[model samples]
Target: MTASPADAEAPLSAHHRKKQPEQVRRALLDCAAQIAAEQGASAITIQAVADRAGVTKGGLLHHFDSKQALLAAVFADLLEQMDREIDRTMAIDPVSRGRFTRAYVRACFSDRLLGERSLWGALSVAIVSEPALRSLWSGWLDSRMAQHAETDGDPRLVAVRLAADGIWLADMMEKAGGLKRYPQDFERVLLAMAEG
Candidate 1:
């Protein structure tokens, strides 16, 4: 016996609802990332993303209204992934917040899996608007840093942030081992500073 149209349609609708928005969001970001990685960030456009995702422009817009929103979504998604990874790493016994920072620095530098280049490109575009993206990104970073800075003084936080910045630069340059070449021995010194 053949299934009725109504029964077939019901399963399809159920499958659509079961489709995770987060998964779709990640796929969209991945497409944008691939485009940016190949031809730089300017290659990322609404049409390009839609084509890459095999979705119609209207469908893409349903999830992300504008190019700026899409770019921000990509950045925000990446940050969320990083936060989750850090959370897992910090689940270790006696995981101080500073250690988490250190782990983040190391991970961001060593693992290109985060697609840091594409993210940097996207971030540059987002921040050029100044008011819109900067506020969003700065708020997220500041909140995370502040949460870690609890009970610790500003000096330690600054030190840890500076260390993270250095790690970011080193990672961008593919100089993972060069952290050891710093004259002041930043990894050890910064850890001490954060702990103190």
Candidate 2:
């Protein structure tokens, strides 16, 4: 049989069949979190993540050039998860001006997230401590507050949202070995405020 130009491209297609870059990046991020969860944030080194993901250090580096980048990816993953959770909750009642704050508060109280803040809190504290990611982290915080500025522009509306954030932060800190957690009724009161 005669070989054609398509045959020449077969080798290139075979190379493309390998795992895409995103998959590798996600693997590294997952491994990093697993490491942090099991061994604490200080254990989330590039080699540890690369080993956990079963990828070469170079391959891991290809997706995340340094440990700080990998840590930033973990933080980004948390932000993305929170965003998705908020949107999912917002779908329940989207019309009200308070929907944004309500959804945000409800999302923070998700069964998966409620009272399991140790791992997340520790990782977040470490992520913020990284000099390379501080600006990006701060920007995320800024945008999070500003996101509802149009519908939630009123001081009262903003206060409810900020209060929700404060409540969640305090709850997480309490879980991180601080004082006792806020009263269980706090969520109920916050929901009322959000709806008011």
Candidate 3:
């Protein structure tokens, strides 16, 4: 038999031949997040995400039933990432009393959640305007609070978390407005509160 150009090429691997469902879903989510970060949540349309992910609209719809569902999933994914980051930060703390609160404070200051160009900043407006997204956020916060009821129940620690929330909002606003409204030591003050 004569060898042809096709015979010289290696066979395609299973990975190349077939796309895993999880991989496709993750790609869609990442594309949605990127679009939101760049152009705000309003830009996360089905066609946009599908096109960005290199998947057909039907493929994207297979993972998410609707645009609202996709947005919810993206919001949930961000919260899950934040939760993991908080857990990682908490693991390094030697103190157990306010460890969770301290981790939350650190996470609030982390780049993942801060700045206008970040996913959280881009989604903040949607979180406020969309009830579904807001509810998901509130549920996540409530679950975390309940989970750490024993270790982070101190009123002072709660105050620290509240302060961290303010700091995060202020930082987002500052970046969005191109102004410096918060003091340079705001994070330091919040961390100090977490220590108590």
Best by lDDT: 3
The estimated TM-scores of all candidates read 0.66, 0.76, 0.86
The per-residue C-alpha lDDT of model 2 at residue 32 equals 85
Q: Tell how far residue 185 is off in model 2, in angstroms.
A: 3.6
**Residue 103 accuracy (lDDT) in model 3:** 89
List candidate 1 segments past 4 Å from native.
1-23, 93-97, 112-118, 121-125, 128-130, 151-154, 166-196
lDDT, candidate 2, at 177? 38
Tens-digit lDDT track for model 3 on 1-196? 8878886696876457766899989999999999998888899999999999998899899999999999999999999999999999888899998888888877776763346668887887788789999899899999999999999998999988887777666655566442256654666788887775
Number of residue pairs clashing in candidate 3, backbone atoms closer than 3 angstroms, sequence gap of 3 or more or interchain:
0
Worst 10 residues of 1 by lDDT: 175-184
**Model 1, total clashes:** 0
Error of 2 at 140 (Å): 3.0
Q: Please name the candidate that would achieve the greatest TM-score relative to the true structure.
A: 3
Which ranking of candidates, highest TM-score first?
3, 2, 1
